[model samples]
Target: MTQKTENTQSGYWFSKIPSKNWSEKFFLYWSLVWITVFSLIVATEAYKVFYDVEFFILGLFVSLPCVVIPYFFPCAADKDKPLWDRYWVKANVWIALFGFVGNYFWTHYFFVLLGATYKFPVDFRLNEVPVFLYFVTHAYFISYHSATTPILRRYWTAFGGKKSTLKTIGSVVIVFAMAYFTAFMEAWTMEKVPYYSIQDRERMYTIGSAFYMIYFIISFPMYARIDETGPQKNEKWSLSRTAIDSLASAMIVFCLCDFWRLIIGSIINPTNSIPFLGTHGIKA
Candidate 1:
């Protein structure tokens, strides 16, 4: 019974490294692969690779691998379970969904608040974002969360392995630091990409990272507990519960993001806009 209890609790937060299954390992490796591929594309200024292809087609090329791979990769935790029923695969799909939704709605905050610009070859857009970017964001979020998990686990252990007030404080500090680091890295890496631009690069790196960290601040920890400890002790989350939790995380971030816009406005924009009741502030 004790061993069964441990088995049920074994997941992202409960374990130091959560790649206990083939699907989990694949998620991590493919995330690295996507990051590497896009980094090279940016470093090489491979604009033709994107521009030559139809935006919709390119979107498919990026998206299909994420959808197709997990269904085939069986989880070691429960080989008898169907592929999609595994925890990591469900987590991947939901995170990818967040990526797509985030690009549609959350990105406009960057455009309005930080004076960011997208120089896409096509005019096709959803909520002022290039359509291909939705797919790109999907891949990026997978990579980001994949990288976030282990590091957070290590930090959580380092600070204190037990539940206590100090550990809680340490967890908050670690989360903020990790969130800020990842957000800044995201800005730094894509700075070379010609299609994406932000006004006042320095401010974007500094102040804008704090603003962007809001996304991970909510998402990172929320995602860690998806399959462990739910309505009942040691009970695994069902697909519906996994999705609901994922959507709840994104929605919380969405609300916090808009709240930032309403209360803080843009410090990165040259105009130094004041906060207002709208999605973005007007130049003062």
Candidate 2:
């Protein structure tokens, strides 16, 4: 009875269970696990890394949303259009707010705990690196998630998926692929900027890539949970639905496109090149 009670919400793809309430919690837990692992791996590799006390706690404030907000306060919608119709930019603001707060808390927490208190070769600056990274990471998440939701929703449902085991595995793959792709692009772009480098994490597949994979896998439902609740009688994207979907999709494309543009800049100007810095921002 006790085991089954806990298993009630445990679903494979999204819920890991049959949980009607606290369903989104699973995602949150995984995100924490991933970030902690990421931070620890990065912290332990002191020769290649320096911890930041300021951004540690700040990461929670902002990152919590990019990781879990959509699951909890998903964009409400009807049945005729995409969930991310016109309000995509507005959603970016919401994500940025979390980024600000998250960066504030997490940076502070890790800075002290990890003794990122000292400077490395680059002289880590809170205003420049920690806060800036939080802000940018938040923006990237908005783009990544907003874009993938529609595709995931469509893909899952299209595959004869109901709310059962099929969805659980499928959900993990979808979110993991999306996140992995995003990371790949970001790492590629970091070639020049190199602000978010992780040379030390390459070895700790469990702490870095594997941990990230688990985060995506476990949190599969948060992004797709609402859609699983069943759509309206009609299948057309509604104003809210369209808004969410389009905005999410657009933000994702926006990130990928800019990342590619960065590649182009590197190609065109070999000596002194920069990506879409002045052209557009990459906040989803």
Candidate 3:
């Protein structure tokens, strides 16, 4: 088969070209739309055209494409399978589940570590935090993970050869660099949103990215493993397997974040509370 055909068949969602499956294609479009919308919103915010609540709501709306599309349109390879067995459905469910955990639980890490305050008020909330916050994180995560996949894939193809030591070293460097850059970009991009406030801008731009880096360090590689093909291909992931992987990654990050809190304490804010349940009651 041609290289192009091989890539298309690989079902690598990170590719610049569209995936062979409609479900992944739609998801790619969905991610691009939100990433663009987010950029536009950031631009508007820069011009004093603020719509913090509306923007978050839009994020929640756009995030549904991943979940909604898979129900009606399973990938071609998955047409004979059950709903949860479908590749797109499994991929979406995995990401949404991970994003949910991150927002519901890890949001507190931002509060305690970076002194992040969600100032925009909304009526619906789970534990004094906006309900849309959880879903909006889905959109953000889609973009972040999508950005990491292609770069890492390229690096792995080029440098991750038969040498296990080189592979390990290359993986470490690439993962750290990508994680740090993506974390800093998100923090910097949303820094001016008026609602998402951090105590120290300078610190957030610099050292704060390290704290956020923990999330992608765990997620980027793990998420890429979903529905693998080509040399990376093993067995396709079951929905159960997907959930287990995502949850395990989240748990690992949770432990790491708590470890950071315990050992280093808050980097941005010295007088922060580190509770097991996170900073929900800390009055963000």
Candidate 4:
């Protein structure tokens, strides 16, 4: 078998020449369309928040794009291949499952422990998750694994000099920095939308961001190994393998987030909350 050479220019912004297959073209086009639509929703939310205006329909538009934007990036396994190709399909499935389950734990369960809860006025729920929020969560994972991580890795490898230790240290720093920014933006947006409320806003913002930082520390490195475009891409794809990897990633993130909850919950509100279990009572 001939050795596969990766495109040196491939990163967040560019991939190799896009597949000319009609199905692939259609998928890419619609992905861009949905991303634009979602951006509009985000923009509407921003306008309402900035102008201090209230609109009953605003919630409907707030989160749907977040789900679609992440899918816009091409999968590593088949960057220039048809959408129906086994690698593309399997990789997307892995990412979707990982995003959905991981987000559920962090958004629904973990946030409650930190004295925060999502307030979606539209009230669409699937098994107790807000439907729009589910999409938003999936989008977050897609964006990170597909786009952000690659870009960060490229730069870290470039700037960290020839030493492996420097590369390792730089990767960690980059991961933490990216995670912190993501968490900070999440906190800021929650505050802006008035979608979530916290008992101690200032402390939660700081601590919650750190909790996410730990999550990325584990996720970024793990993804680098399992990504379809990574070392395992040449291996035959299988449902069993995808399921196992996705479950493992979700479990790792869940445990890490909960571990932080345990440690932080004990210090912040041990009287009402159990360590590792999170805070008591649902927020109104």
Candidate 5:
């Protein structure tokens, strides 16, 4: 016969096991495995041969803030909140999906219709775009801007206290600067891996960088409004809500990009048109 005691060693073990929630457990295990694999790959020659240094630098720039800000000042949704309430996790999931989908369409336009090619390491094409490239360009970039914009806004408010014309102008300048730098880096990296047959590298750099600036223009203010954690604590968080918002944002960006292409084709040069097949008399 066994004594039924709530404080038994076996009972304690079972109790502790059940206390760990599935979402936390899943994320913990997944993070550990991902970090281990990523670290090992970076340690290998395969990484050196297959990965571009610029891509790595870009990833570092974006991912560091995403990790650090949350570490020190985590989203209110993450504190004693349910898994669905965790904005970061939800954002990542939604962005990754969007990235993959968006890349599938846009990449084909650039590569096939526009007759562009990629450099060696940066050329691991998947669904038209590079695999790891999606993480740098989409996942990390979106998350970084979404999380940082609010923090930057708060900091500016704290420093300036009351808003002024000068402060507002200064904030706009700062935001533009950040957007330009990000676009510049991406364009600079792409230039390093010259898209074959696409002469006029400077033109590519200028246009590509300018086009990417739209991402920040649309995302910064949108995130500032929708991605707040502190204000969202009182509201119920669910996967469906996150999904809807993310999808809406993705569609907005997509339409804007396509619209830009249409405008460019009509005004500038049809040869420079994006959204493949959007331009009349253009053959893919």
Candidate 6:
């Protein structure tokens, strides 16, 4: 339980004792809306002003899991099981890492392709941090779906065997397209904001989007498996599965992604060259 303290004389907000389930309140519909929908809007708008086509492409791949994932995989928690178990926690962590770590590979390569001699002056090691951070920060999208996925288990359950497969495939396409559209919108945003500049970053964005689609198509089966397992309250290992809780878990994962980058950045890119997630994350 969390503990809270108060000074009778001088007023000061203090510690709060852990309510039986307060720590996990984040894994609900409210949390998902807060994190995912709004993020999509802001990211969409930001990309439009800041990076245009780059954002559109990024948005497309991101949409696949964001949509298909939550609809299919249901959570293991309910009124009977008040507190989040280990599996939920673990699931969240993994999805976040999956996106963050995965992107590192592409982002670094993009930098190499980018001539550091430009006005931006990218150092191979330093510039590459943004690529890694980009992936890590974006990983939260998957996490949000993970949490929300549980809520929609009943809906997907209605569709069985052939229908379910059809729905899943169709969904992948829809999300992929919607995400891409957003990417395009974001690309437009880049024209205005101009957060980044160079020659072929647009191409890099396209490549990244393609990678996301390929990865999502391949990963669908695994996500389906998670759906099959549904929510298992008794399962002690469950809460740790941060991959399970789409919303709250994703936000938590987002936090971890940054933490992971921070730890790595301390060693590799201390100059805050990571772009969106530099020394002053989401700031400069």
Give Cα-based local distance difference scores for all models: 0.69, 0.41, 0.71, 0.54, 0.50, 0.38
Off by over 4 Å in 2: 1-90, 105-130, 159-161, 194-201, 204-207, 212-221, 224-284
The TM-score of candidate 2 is 0.39
Write down the TM-score of every candidate: 0.82, 0.39, 0.82, 0.67, 0.57, 0.40
List the candidate numbers ranked by TM-score, top first: 1, 3, 4, 5, 6, 2
Model 2 poorest 10 in a row by lDDT: 109-118
**lDDT score of model 4?**
0.54
Clashing pairs in 3: none
TM-score of 6: 0.40
Total clashing residue pairs per candidate? 0, 67, 0, 2, 0, 65
Candidate 1 lDDT over 54-132, as tens digits, reads 6567566665677676555544554577654666667766787678667877777787777676777776766667777
Clash count in backbone of candidate 1: 0
Clashing pairs in 1: none
True-vs-predicted CA distance for residue 147, candidate 6, Å = 9.1
Ranking by lDDT: 3, 1, 4, 5, 2, 6
User: In candidate 3, what are the lDDT values of residues 71-162, reduced to their tens digit?
Assistant: 66655565677776566666677788888888878877777777676776555666556777777787777767766776676666554233
What digit string (tens of lDDT, one per residue) describes model 2 on residues 1-284?
A: 57534333332323222231132343344446545655564556532543355445444554555435444454333123233431332344444543454354333322221112223333344533434366446645554544555456555655443477777687667777876665455444433333443334332222233222322332233434333344542232234553454345434444443443344323223343343332122111
Taking all chains together, the TM-score of candidate 1 against the true structure is: 0.82
**Candidate 3 overall lDDT versus native:** 0.71
Q: Best by TM-score, which number?
A: 1
lDDT per residue for candidate 4 within 196-269, as digits (tens), equals 65767776678767765665666665654432343543344466677677778778888876766655553246
C-alpha positional error of residue 123 in candidate 4 after TM-score superposition, expressed in Å: 4.2
Show the colliding residue pairs in model 4: 38-65, 262-276
**Superposing all C-alpha atoms, what RMSD in Å does each candidate have to the true structure?**
4.2, 18.2, 4.3, 6.5, 12.7, 16.4
